[model samples]
Each structure stands twice: as C-alpha cells, then as structure tokens.
Target: MCVISGTHGVEGFCGSGAQIALLEDAAVIAAVEKYGVAVMFYHALNPYGFSYCARTNEDNIDLNRNFRDFSRPLPVNAAYREVHDFMVPSTWPPTPENEARIGAYLSTRGEAALQAAVSGGQCDCADGLFYGGAAPAWSNGVFRDMLRRHAASRRRFAWIDFHTGLGPYGHAEKIHSGPNDAAMIARARAWYGIDVTSFHDGSSTSAVLTGVNYEAPLEECPGVECTGIALEYGTLSLLETLQALRGDAWLRNHPDADAKTRAAIKRRCRDAFYCDADDWKAMVYDQARDACLQAITQLAAAPVPH
Candidate 1:
C-alpha cells in the first residue's frame, strides 16, 4: 500500500499533517502489519511548493498535471485558452474592467465550463493555472522511479493520495483514479465504501483531468494491477479556493510586492487549502485511517498476481 499527500504543495499541509499523524499512530501501524501490508509514505511530492506555500513547483508546474507522456501530443484545453487572460490578468486582484469581463464570460459559459477550463489541466500555458508541464517534472521522474522500485514486485497495488480544496468543508471525498471497468469500480466501492465517485461517471467534485499523478504507477508498472483513489478533503468553497489560487499566482508573478501583500496572499492560500482547526484535523485523520485500513484488509485477502 502506498499513501501520498502534498502533491499540490501549499495543499500539502493538510495531507502531510495527516500522513505524519497516521504514521505516528500505533494503531495504524499495527493494523497494516497485521494485514501483512507494506506501506510506503510519500509526503510533500512538491517540496518547493510546500516550502514556499505555493500551489505550483519551482517552475510553476502543477505537479498533479505534470504526469503526461510528453512524447505524444499534449492535451489541449480550448476552454482554458478562452479564459486564460481573464483568469490571470496583468494586475493582481484584477482590475474592475477585467472582473466585469470575467463575469461576462462566466455568465455566458456557465460554472461547469469554467471549472473544466480552469481545472482540467492544460499544456499550452506554462505559467497558467493547472498547467501540465511541457516535459516530465522532477517530481514526475521521482514518482515514476519510486513506483518502479517499490511497486514493481507487487501484483496488486492500492494507493490513497490525499488532497484538499474541492468539496463540502471537512468532508472526505473518495475519488476513483484507475480504470473505469465495472469490476474495478465495484472493487473500489467495496473497499472504500459506496461514497466513492469516479471522474468518468461525472460524480466527482473534480473535473475530468489529464496528466494526473495517480496514472504514473500504471505507466511505470504495467505488470501490477494498480488501484488508486484520491482522498480529497474539503476546506473552502470552490469560489474561495479559486480566489486563493489566483491570488497566489499573482503573488508569484509579482514577487516584488510588499511584505503585507505577500503575507495576505499566503494566508489566503493556506485558508483555501487548510482548515487549521482541531475538528477539521480530526476528521481528516479519521477518514484517512478508515480508508487505509479498508485498503489493507481488501489487498490482504486478494491473491498476488503472477
């Protein structure tokens, strides 16, 4: 079993915290060992983003979107092209005229279109939101290597990647990330419970994305039947999360901004991704513990594939 968190950098605080908390818990460890499961913990996949409290990496690549096969044609997002300028303007906070322009676009295009355009992972713009890098990022290479080394021998693999910023506050949404076959879906639902949602089924809070991190394992270890889920915990509302992301991007673009402005942007980024409350942390830990245990139990019963 592999558990990962902090793939989004600034969003890493919640996941990293949960990983640390879970790892330290004797019960969690005992349960995994009892089930004869080997657990690999990956914390802060994007160290730069985690350290700087930004969403993207040193090159401003969204690590979650940087997992595509670069030898082939990159996935295009025409919708993202339509709203790129409006989303990230020349000025921070956006001018009133720009805001009006965005409002007009949203009124015409609708929220779903906006969500798909912004969050669907674009390869055209290197500096824009959810930009899948032109080439494999450092994190991508590291993760691929880790999969080959650690998971290649395993016949069945189960993963739970922790994330934040896209659901009801404090709720954990189990998102299916592997193949959408009925059997696979059934198995995931059985293990994680019926609350699981699949991106293919249009039931997930997330938009259909390209170059997601979870696909890396399948690409690296084709011999293994890899099953993965993104345990997305909610912090703020969608609009608020977008605002915070935009604010952080603006700060990145304008690094010379005053300390107060920078601090405020950082604070917004944190609030957008992390609840910073005891109750919220408790919910995160409980959900993670339950999910991990479920995966361990199911994998233990299944025979290892040859």
Candidate 2:
C-alpha cells in the first residue's frame, strides 16, 4: 500500500501530516506487521509546489495531470482556452467583468460542465489551470522509477494520493484514481466501501481528469492488481479555492508584484488547500487512517501470488 502526499504541493501539509499520524497509528502498525503489508509513505511528490505553497510546479505543470504518455495526441480542452483570458486576467483580483464572464459561463453551462471544461486536464494551455505538460516532467520519471524499484514486485498494490481544495470542508472524497476500468473501480469500492466515487460516471466531485498520478502505477507496475484513489480532502469552497489558484497563477506570471500582494496570494494559496485548524486536522487524520487501514486489510486478505 502506497500513501502518497504532496501531489499538489501546498496540499502536502495535510497529506504529510496524515502520513506521520498513520506511521504512529498503533492499529496501522499492528496491521502491517500482522498482514505483512508493505506500506510505502512517499512524501512531497512535487517538492517545488510544496515549498512555494503553489498547486503547480515551477513550470506551472499540475503534477497530478502530468503523468501520461506524451507521445500520444493529448486531449485538447478548447473550453479552457475559451475561459483562459478571464480566468487569469491582467489584474490580481479579477475584474467584475471577468467574474461576470465566468458567472455567465457557469449559468449557461452549469457547474459540472464548467468544472469539466476547466479542470479536465488541458494539454494546450501551458499557462492555464490544470495544465498537463506537453512532455513528461522530471518528477514523473522519478516516480515511475520508484514504482519499478519498490512496487513492481507486489502482486496487489493499492495507492491513496492525497489532495485538497474540493468538496465540502473537511470531507475526504475517495475519488477513483485509475482509468475508467470497471473491474478496477469495483475493487476500489470493495476495498474502500461504497463511498468510493468515480469521475468517469459523474459520481465524484472531480472532473473526468486525464494524466492522473494513479496512471503511473498502471504503467510502471504492469500486471499488478492495483487499486487506487485520490483522497481529495475539502478545505474551502470550490470558488474560493479557484480564486486562490488564480491568485497563484497571477503571482507566477507577475514576479514584479508588490510584496504584500505576493504574501497575500501565497497565504490564500496555502489556506485554500490546508486548513490549520486542529479539528480539521483531526478529521483528516481519522479519514486517512481509515482509508489506509482498509487498503491494508484488503491487501492482507488477498491470496499470495505463486
């Protein structure tokens, strides 16, 4: 079982915390020993994002959306292109007209359509939100190397990649992380329970994303029975989180901005993904432990490979 943190950089606070908590968790420790479950806690998949409190890497690549075969034709998101100008406007705080354009789009297309358009992993927009890079990132290659070195030997592998800035505050949405494979989704639901939701079927808060980090395991650990989810913990409302992301993008584009503006945008970016409250951390740790335990149990129960 792989418990990955920092797929989104700033969101690593909660995910890294949960990893520490799980490491010290008596039940988890006991289960690992009893079942011989190899729990690999990989931290800070995107160190640059984690350090800078930004969602994307230094290259503005969303690392979560950066894991794909770049040789194939990438998915074009014309919708993201349509909204790009307003989404990251000329100003720090978007003008009323810019927001009005977004509001108008939301009103006409509905929230789901807007989300799918905006966050469905756009390859065309290097400067836009959720931009999957035109080529494999250095981190992507390193991650695959880790999988081949440590995880390829396992017959049954389960992964939980932690994320933030979506859904109700403090709720951990277990989003099916692999491809739209029925058998894989069933295994996830069976291991993690019915709460496991899939974007492929519109059952998840996330859009139908491509180039997700989970794809790494499928490619790297070929033929392994893998089950995974992006445990997206909600920190703030979607709109607020989005505004934070915009502020981040704007900051990245404008290094000459004032110190106060820079600080405020960084704070906004961190706050959007990481709630510092004790109660919220407690909730996150609890859900994370539960998810890890579930995977451990399933991994233990599976028959040993011949």
| TM-scores for all predictions | 0.97, 0.97
TM-score of 1: 0.97
Query: Candidate 1: where are CA atoms >4 Å away?
Result: none
List, residue by residue over 195-233, the lDDT tens digit for candidate 2.
899999999999888888888899989878888988899
Stretches of candidate 2 exceeding 4 Å from the true structure: 304-306
Query: Model 2: clashing residue pairs?
Result: none
Computed on alpha carbons, the lDDT of every model, listed in order, comes to 0.87, 0.89
Worst 10 residues of 1 by lDDT: 177-186
